[model samples]
Target chain A: SAVISQKPSRDICQRGTSLTIQCQVDSQVTMMFWYRQQPGQSLTLIATANQGSEATYESGFVIDKFPISRPNLTFSTLTVSNMSPEDSSIYLCSVEQTGGNNEQFFGPGTRLTVL
Target chain B: LAKTTQPISMDSYEGQEVNITCSHNNIATNDYITWYQQFPSQGPRFIIQGYKTKVTNEVASLFIPADRKSSTLSLPRVSLSDTAVYYCLVGGPPGAGSYQLTFGKGTKLSVIP
Candidate 1:
């Protein structure tokens, strides 16, 4: 198990503003991912943050809206750009262990509310 | 990714064993069955994973038959704190671009006293 932490546990932001959420892991991990959970909905994969390269965004999500940066193995950031009211959701950062079989450790999450 | 089907909710009493079955009719040969538990406003926690037969840990047990079409997650001696949403996922491990974990609505298990 990995101990993961995220900054800005909860935040309130105005529409059209941008917020970057930080995710820090206790140890180095191979792959990091970002997800979104809307109100009363299941979790959706936002992107895969790859080290030393551009993040891979899932369908229905684009880099312009949600840009991610993974500078190192233990840390990454996801910036919700040009936020809107519908962008209010819980953002989570997760890491998959090198040898683990489909197991992922998640951060506490950043709860963002756009007004 | 294989699609998973699970019940929307389940009701159980404390100290009773709860079994939640997930059906993945299109499960591939290389795909594995995994379970996760999520609390309110928290990330999902990995419960167990198994390819076939039975796999048990301190927290729960995963039972997969030979057919590989379905699997069961057995929580022994449930408690009130066990009330949460349990998600069942069917996919291969990381490295195969199986990073996207498709989450179903999940079975909301309420352990009543």
Candidate 2:
């Protein structure tokens, strides 16, 4: 298991502002992913942050709205651009191990509430 | 990606065993069943994983039948702390290259004292 941490554990932001969440893993990993959990709902994949490449955004999510950066194996960032009340949700980061079960480890999550 | 179906909620008393079943009719041969637990305001925690038969860890046990279309996650004993949402996901290992997890509406377990 990897120790994962996210910055800005909880924050309140005004509408139209952007918030960038940082995810840091204690060890190197192959794949990093970003997920969003709406209030009282299941998680939705925002994108998969690929090293040295652009992030793969899921359907209904676009790069311009939620840009992601994965510069190296152990770190990644997701920026919610031009936020709105609908964008208020818990953003989480997870890393996939290389071999065996390849179980993913998750960060605590960044809870953002856009006012 | 194989979609999963699970109960929306379950109720159990403390000290009693609990079993949650998940169904994935189109599960691929290489696909594995994984279970996760999530508390309020926290990330999901991996409980167990199995390709077939039974797999047990310190946290929970996964029972997969011969057809591999369904799985059961059995908790030996329940506690109030176990009151949370449980998720069932189906996918192959990272080697599959997708490396993405799809979370359904997990079963909410409420352990009463």
Candidate 3:
């Protein structure tokens, strides 16, 4: 199990502004992912962060809008650019343990509200 | 990624056993079933994962049918704190081309006192 933490537990931003959320893991993880959960909706994977390389994004999500950075094995960041009201959601970071059990552990998440 | 289908909501009383079932008709041979619990305003927490038959842990037990098309997550003597949204996830083996983890609409368990 990994202890994950996210910065800015909750934030309120204006439209067109960008917010960067940070995710820190206690142990080095090979596979890291970002997810979004809107109100009354299930989680949706935003991207998979690969160490030292570009993050692999899911369909319907673009890097220009949601850029990710994974400089090391234990840390990553996701930036939401040109935010709008539709982008208001809870952003979470998760890490898959590098062993047989592929269960993913998640962070508390950063709640973003765009006005 | 195999799409999952589960109940939208459920009601249970404290101290009762709760079972939430999920269906994944297109589950692959290497796909594993996993469950997660999420409280309001918090990230989803891992509960259990299993490939076939039954797997028991300290908190929950997962029962997978022989066909691997459905799975049930059973929580014993659930308490009020256990009231949360439970998610069922299916994914193929790591590094496999079809190994994409997708979160489906989960079952919301409301445990009453």
Indicate which candidate wins on lDDT. 3
* Candidate 3 per-residue C-alpha lDDT over A1-115 given as tens digits, one digit per residue, 9 for 90 to 100: 7999999899999999999999999999888999999998999999999898999999999999999999999999999999999999999999887764667889999999999
Worst 10 residues of 2 chain B by lDDT: B92-101
TM-score of 1: 0.96
Q: Which segments of model 2 are wrong by more than 4 Å?
A: B94-96
- lDDT for position B107 in model 2: 98
- What DockQ score does model 3 reach against the true complex? 0.61
Model 2 quality (TM-score): 0.97
Off by over 4 Å in 3: B94-100
Q: Which segments of candidate 1 are over 4 A away from where they belong? A: B93-97
Ten contiguous residues with the weakest lDDT in model 3 chain B: B92-101
TM-score of each: 0.96, 0.97, 0.96
For candidate 2, give the DockQ: 0.68
- Show how many residue pairs clash in every candidate, following the order shown: 0, 0, 0
Q: Give per-residue lDDT, candidate 3, residue A103.
A: 74
Residue pairs whose backbone atoms clash in candidate 3: none
Of candidate 3 chain A, the 10-residue stretch with the lowest lDDT total is: A96-105
Judged by lDDT against the true structure, how good is candidate 2? 0.91
